[model samples]
Target: MLHSKSILSFVLVLFISGCSSVVLPIDERALINDIKAKYQGEILAPEDLKKGDITTYSFPPVWGFNVRSYFSRDGSFSLDREFYRFKNEDRGSTIFEHFIESEGDIEKTGRQIILKNRIAYRKYDSSSDLNYLSTFKECEFKLGTCTYKSASGKDKKVKTYFENGVWTSEYEGFRNSKLIETKIYHKSGLLIFSSYKGLIRGNTSYSNREAFEANSL
Candidate 1:
C-alpha cells in the first residue's frame, strides 16, 4: 500500500503547478475527539454486536503528531487531494513550484492507519526530456498542524480534518485552474471496499464512522 503512495509521488514530480486555497491549522487531539464524538455508530465493539448483526467501525486518529488512525470496520474513508498544475505553450499540463499548494491522503487497512501529505514542486523545461525538475516536501503533523518547508525557505502549515471517516480536503492548484480530482472510498468489514476517483466532487460520501476492536488503540 505504501508502495502505491511512493509511485504516485514519483510520477507527480514530472508535473508543474498553480494557485492554492487557504487551509487553517488544526489540533490533532481536538480533531480526534471530535470524530469519536460525532461518528459513534461505525465503531461498534464485539460485545455491542451480536452474530449476524451488521456493524461497521472506523477509529479516530490517535494523539501525537500523526494524521493516521488505527483499527477496522463497516464504515468508509473518503479522500479529496489536490495537485498543482501548469499549462505550456503546446497546451501540455505541468506542475510547477510557484503555482500554489498540493498534497494529502488518509487510509486504513486492518489495524494500521496512515496519513500522507506531500507538496511537490517541479520546474518546467520544454526542451528537456524530463520536462520537470524534482523538488518535494512531505509534511508531518506537529503542534496541531502539518508543517511544510517551502521551496522559498519559508515554513508553511496546512490542516484538513478527517471526521466521521470522511476526509474532504481542498488544495488551491495552479493560477489558471482547469480540473481537480477527488476520490471516494467505501470499506466493508474485513477490508472489502470500493473507490472512485474523478474530476468532479463526489456526493456519495457517508458519515458512518466506528472502531471495531474495542481495546486496539
Candidate 2:
C-alpha cells in the first residue's frame, strides 16, 4: 500500500508539471509577413530582428522622417509615422517641427485596421518640450497632396496645405493663443529646406528658415 501511494503521488506531480509547462504557440514570421502584405510596401527590418520573437521595422529615408512598426509577443502591433524639419542647420539636422502622420494599433481580425484614437500634432520652437502649437484629431490620413480628416467635433478641421512645391502645416492653440506654422520643401522624399513661424506673448513673432544646399560644404 505504501509503494502504491508513492507511485500515485509521483504521477500526480507529473500531471501538474505538464499542465504548468504548456506554452501557447507563436509564429513571429507569420505575423511579420501578414503586416508586410497588408501595407504593400517594403518594410526595412529593424537591426534587432530575430526569430520567434518581437521585432520592429524602421523604414527610410531614415533622415528627417521616421516610420516605426512594432510587433508584440501577444500578436498585437502598432505603427507610428512621424516627420520632422531641421532646426539647427548650422550644426547639421535638428528637429524644428514634428508632425505625427499616423499612430495606432494594427489589429488582425479577418482584416487589419488602425484603431481610431486621439492623436495630436505638435510644433516646437527649439529642441525643448515647449510646444508652441498643437492640433487634435481622432483620425488623419495623407493621400498625395490631400489629407482626409475623419476626426469629429471641434477638432475635425483639416489644417495642412500643399501648394506649388511645398507642404505647409499650421497650429494655433498653445500658450496664450499663440500661432505656429511650418513649411517643408522636399525632393524625392528628402528634405531640402524648412521654415517656421510662431507668435510670442507680447504680440510679436519669431521665425527661422534652414536651407540645405546641394553643393554647399
Candidate 3:
C-alpha cells in the first residue's frame, strides 16, 4: 500500500547507503610515508631481525603457517616459508624479498629512510619454472602500500588508510580482480580487532593482553 513517492524515496536511500560503503583509493606514496612515520624506530636491524618470528593463525578451512623474516643491514628483507618443501634443496625457496631504497636515489628523513622502488620475486625453480617477478613502485620501510606489476605486466594498486583508530588496507589485483580488504584495530601496537573480506573472509577480536599473547615474537 506504499505510494509511488515513498517507493522512490526508499530506492534513493539504498543507493546512498551503497555509495557510502564503497572504498575510494588514496595516494599510494603518501600512505606509505604516513605508516613509516608512525613506526619510525620499529624497523628491525639485521641482528635483531634474526631473533624474532611472526606466526599468523588462519581461520578454520585455511592452513596456518609460520613466517621467519630476515632483514639485512642494507635495508632489505626476505621472507622464507617454513613449511614448504622442495625435492631440490638448491632451488630458490624465498616467498618474497623487499629491497628497499637499494636501487634508486635514497631519500632520508632524520634516521628513517623512505624507499622509492622495490622488487619482489616469488619462488623459482631453476630446473623448470620461470621466476615470477612483481615490481613495486613507491614502497616504504616495509610492504605497506604500493603499486605491484606482475610478471605479465599487469598492475595492481594497494593502499592503506587509518580512521577512528582502525587501519584498513585494500588490495585490488587478484586474478578475478576482486578487492581484498583488511581492517586492523589495535592499541599499544597490539591487534585488538582484525577482519578480512573479499576473497578470504574472517573476523576476529581480542583484548589487550590477549593480543600480546597471540604474538609469537
Best by TM-score: 2
Candidate 3 lDDT over residue span 58-136, tens digit each: 2111111222221222323232211111112122222221112323332221221111111223333323333323133
Q: Look at candidate 2 and tell me the lDDT of residue 206.
A: 29
For model 1, how does the per-residue alpha-carbon lDDT over 11-94 read when each residue is reduced to its tens digit? 111112123231112232343344445434533233322454432223222211111221113223332322211122112222
Residues 40-74, model 2: lDDT tens digits: 33222212122324222221322322222222234
Worst 10 residues of 1 by lDDT: 1-10
Name the lDDT value of residue 128 in candidate 2: 33
Pitting candidate 2 against candidate 3, the one with the higher lDDT is 2
Quote each prediction's TM-score.
0.20, 0.27, 0.26
Backbone collisions counted per model: 27, 0, 0
Instruction: Name the best candidate (by lDDT).
Output: 2
What is the alpha-carbon lDDT for the whole of candidate 1? 0.25
Residue 39 Cα positional deviation in candidate 1, in Å, after optimal superposition: 14
- Candidate ranking under TM-score, highest first, comes to 2, 3, 1
Candidate 1 root-mean-square deviation in Å? 20.1
User: RMSDs, each prediction?
Assistant: 20.1, 25.0, 19.7
Clashing residue pairs in candidate 2 (N, C-alpha, C atoms within 3 angstroms): none
Over 4 Å off, model 1: 1-147, 150-157, 176-217
lDDT of 3 at 20: 29
